[model samples]
Target chain A: MVTETSLSPIATFHSARRGRYEVAHQGVLALGEGTIVVEPGHNFEQGLQGLKGFDRLWLVYLFHLNQTEDAPPVMVKPPRFEHKVGVFATRSPHRPNPIGITPARLLHVAGRMLTVAQADLLDQTPIVDIKPYLPFCDAFPEAAVGWGGLAPTPYRLLWSEGARERVAEIASAHDLRLDHYAEVQLQLDPTDTSRKRIRATEQGFALDFREWSLHYEVRGEAQEVWIEQVTERPEFPGPSSLK
Target chain B: MVTETSLSPIATFHSARRGRYEVAHQGVLALGEGTIVVEPGHNFEQGLQGLKGFDRLWLVYLFHLNQTEDAPPVMVKPPRFEHKVGVFATRSPHRPNPIGITPARLLHVAGRMLTVAQADLLDQTPIVDIKPYLPFCDAFPEAAVGWGGLAPTPYRLLWSEGARERVAEIASAHDLRLDHYAEVQLQLDPTDTSRKRIRATEQGFALDFREWSLHYEVRGEAQEVWIEQVTERPEFPGPSSLK
Candidate 1:
């Protein structure tokens, strides 16, 4: 009995996670930090008075990057799932209403700006609402996760000295988060070549980036993915190399 | 920099709690059942697949009853708090976006219809989205609840035989839910006469409900409110009497 509703952004999120590939699917796995700056001229400062006391907050934000003009697909392939699940069953950005809710660990609240960690939002994302996370009402530790529980457990990421140095150099030179991207893609189902640009190498596995490649070995027993080396493709010269 | 965004409803919620006074502030305390009937012709049936496995779900719905056309007030007085806190600090329905998210216990899902319990939504409320509640991503048991933690504990309600019979008679005759309304209002702070239309009687406390009155006595030490009687106002003639 209700018509379409209109909403306006109250704040902007500033984060280093620039692209979808750089951010994790789950906010809890997103290691990056972000700041939410509430717009001035409103009484938002007064509204934010008691929010600092809470250790965590629920941020309701818009999925600004969803460019689909038609109705969202009925089914979606979650990166963690091998099969296509219903769009309602998965936390896909493409939905009837392009809205997202993530619980971020509240780090600091200074006036109209709030800093939060483990946020999966992209840079300049619009935030619509912020509510303190009440454990008594929000937390349901015993609830069954259903199909989500069947997803493969995340593999602990490890970097060798050589790989770490190479990744750092590439990150500083190109402002690309290769290491973060690798973790986001490889942490779960590191050997799923069907979903990721991965292939079997003589040593172990090699995941291909734009112009660079990451060589990693999966220690299945220990649940770890060790990155042994990082190298640029011989045929493709990158911007950093040309510079 | 994004402009105003528009959203359409994907489903309609049917619940017995019709009015604002009948619904609890927290969905976990609503103690009522509701069904979400997803709209047809949108392939919503396929979108509902695999959702039945989840024991709980997060429902994102619009606050349709919010009639204010202007920007929402920055500060709102929570029923549990004496002082007005930031609107974002509490789960107030009056918000800039007017969107609400509540975690509900999933009971059943058949085709495009899903049954849930403890939903704090009004009848025929428009639902925007539904996502499975993943405990790992949602649960924060130790998160400090800030001002919410300081709210007084709920008082268990006890009804006498006579009061129960009277309430049942009124409920069947007038289709009124007096028992549910009492629980929604009295469970938190029954003695607070400022917010509720309550007055002190010679025997105990009386809560006004239209032409009907509920007489109850608060046992502070036991944290219980005992309903002694349910009576119609002497001046107000009831439809049951006329029948």
Candidate 2:
């Protein structure tokens, strides 16, 4: 039998929020609120000294939220697909080894903090190691995509003036990134019900983000997400201004 | 303090050899011995079905050799530079979390055995997780490099007939991958003393790997690794045919 190694996190992440991250953004936004701040522990901050010179890095982290004291499941039902595939075949968090790896852009370094872009990890995730992204070694653009091939049909995000006003009110009260939410949920493919935050509506589709639900209509060919209505759940009271 | 998740290796690696990996081939050979077999444990093998459609993968593994029962170093002395840098700045294995991440090609898959290519890992390494390499998300060719920006100068590996024959014999007896050794040691920039397997010799330089010493001369521009001498230590017996 092989002996395994015990390890601890060298750093922790501070991000927008953490939970079941259903959006497989593919590390697309490597900047802004989407940016992940990697804070090196105590003496480990020096490791960030010369990292600013590199444009990219590999985030080796633990799948903290997915950890359980059981033999990981071999089969997984991916977001877009209905049939079960091997855990190795999919990037599902449920696995034999709860390790997460993502490629991120290193925006800048400040003291012990590193502002990075395009991270697929949850907030406060434990980092295992950081390696510079070597282009000649890591990139393979022409390679064929496995079962995850098709590009979601492009859909324009159309928000009415009233929809925008309502979202702004919700945003101010909740400190939610409603603009980013609109882009992430409505822009990618609003008509694709398989995506997170998207659901069928009487006239079109409804997008969900935390306490807010956005009602939108899919125009002809599902090419546009025409946001028609915006509302918050009564359970969570809105600002007195909204009342 | 934040709580960390405990992880276990899902599959074990079976490669040419194991132990201290003194070479970093950069997955340049992503085609041969560069190929690695990934055997999913128990029912996990079923997870790999239909993965061949993808061209690349991410290998998350444990740095077993660098593990210890003590605090990890925050400062690291990398192979290319002598100065101590932040543990996060360098890809040194002596990290707080001894984890290794490598991007590789998916050449083919047969049953439970997957022939993955271009990994910079040691034999029998414990793989924690495997993810498909999604090109649109992972590759960043134009990304800037920090202290590791400069690419090593190219060098040609020239071996005399006798040297080749001698290596063939030694390789046969000791089960060494001589071609891999020559390619890694020769193809990389020879002038950079920061690389592994290099030492100053009386005339030029000596490249060391495992139990053998290769004497080579670098030309005026340090552009060639002319292997003129090949000898094994008397302690390590050679094939009788060599006599």
Candidate 3:
């Protein structure tokens, strides 16, 4: 035997999507595209407006992707670890209670189409709760860098054939600049490797765009692109990656 | 006017110490040193034990300190941030929900006497719920490091008097390590600045204590000290510096 450990339940997450939200068991919240609505409601108007001003908000979503009938994993291979570290050290999707949170940006709030900046969730990823980023309260200035240092640093982006068009379209619609390195830094690579080496390689921008970071590799003049998908599973190819 | 933008809620914490625990609103909880035991039924026992194995556990406790008819702060100066930053940025004890979650470690669980590490809570700090660390799911390996870098680094204590003796006696009786830097990290400066600086100096050593890092630090030159009281806030007779 590998001498595995057992896990127990702690809490349940109540979640839902744009129009649907349910807290299933402890720490299990279900959310999807329909969870958030642009229309202002009595209990939600203030929160919605507060959410619009920021580029990104923290989604304290439940990790439904990791929920199981039996005990879930205590450790996971966090995307930042590139499948090399223990579960506890990484932010792998599989875990007990499966509660997950991500700082996603607000793209637009048109009536009911509450567009968001690059989110890793599917068309209907269940969202548990949303909190605005109070830059003062949320960001830890001197926090120590752990294995995340292994993630690619100095973020750079080399869009695929059609990815640039999509990004540009999204940027224009939102009146936000999405092409600069600083903009790209918003989505950090879990691996602290250099983007110049990977995107500049001959393979034409080998980039990895997950729900969080956008990693790229360049060869010769062509950029080898590997956009890390933002789903719970790192092995799963993203919609953009398929192209 | 500075032409400042009011983006999020602001709050202020009185002190980081033990007081009393009580239930307030429907979802709100209060933490105090006086009210230690809450009839968490026998069913919670299994769940509580599951939480003890982790290096850090999230305590979803109520902010009993802020009990009033007035609304809670829209922003807060997190104890770790000192008072320099806005309430939104720091994890101050005050908040709109009046809810607090401290990442603490489990030393041992003899019945209900849970000896925890990194418990910035006061003696008899009321614990509403305890959830173990599912490293795979909880750690945000790539999250940004904001003001944490600017905060002061914690200093090591070379005990001058019988502080070491007091710590030893308390630890032996309670099966606790009172003198470890982690304990001081939570107590010395219940203010966010002190916590931030201390965490910075030691690279969040308090966070490391739960994951076998405490054992390593205890083995080092730093001597352990016992806590004399968990109810009163220690006086720091200096001008309150903004973190």
TM-score of chain A of each: 0.91, 0.77, 0.47
lDDT of 2 by residue, B119-174 (tens): 77777777777788777777777777777655555566788888888888876897
| Per-residue accuracy of model 3 over A151-189 as CA lDDT, tens digit each | 233233345555566555645674333343222332344
The weakest ten consecutive residues by lDDT in model 1 chain B span B234-243
DockQ of 3: 0.04
lDDT of 2 by residue, A95-181 (tens): 777777777877777776678767766677877677778776777677678786444554677789998998778768866656556
Pick the TM-score winner. 1
CA shift of B122, model 3, Å:
2.4
DockQ ranking of the models:
1, 2, 3
- Superior by lDDT: candidate 1 or candidate 2: 1
Compute the DockQ of candidate 1. 0.70
Model 2 docking category: medium
RMSD of 2: 5.3
Question: RMSD per prediction, one decimal?
Answer: 3.7, 5.3, 15.8
Error of 2 at A39 (Å): 6.0
lDDT (Cα, tens digit) per residue for candidate 1, span B71-136: 778888888578888998989999878899999999999988999998989898999889999988
Question: Where does the lowest 10-residue lDDT sum fall in candidate 3 chain B?
Answer: B1-10
Higher-DockQ candidate among 1 and 3? 1
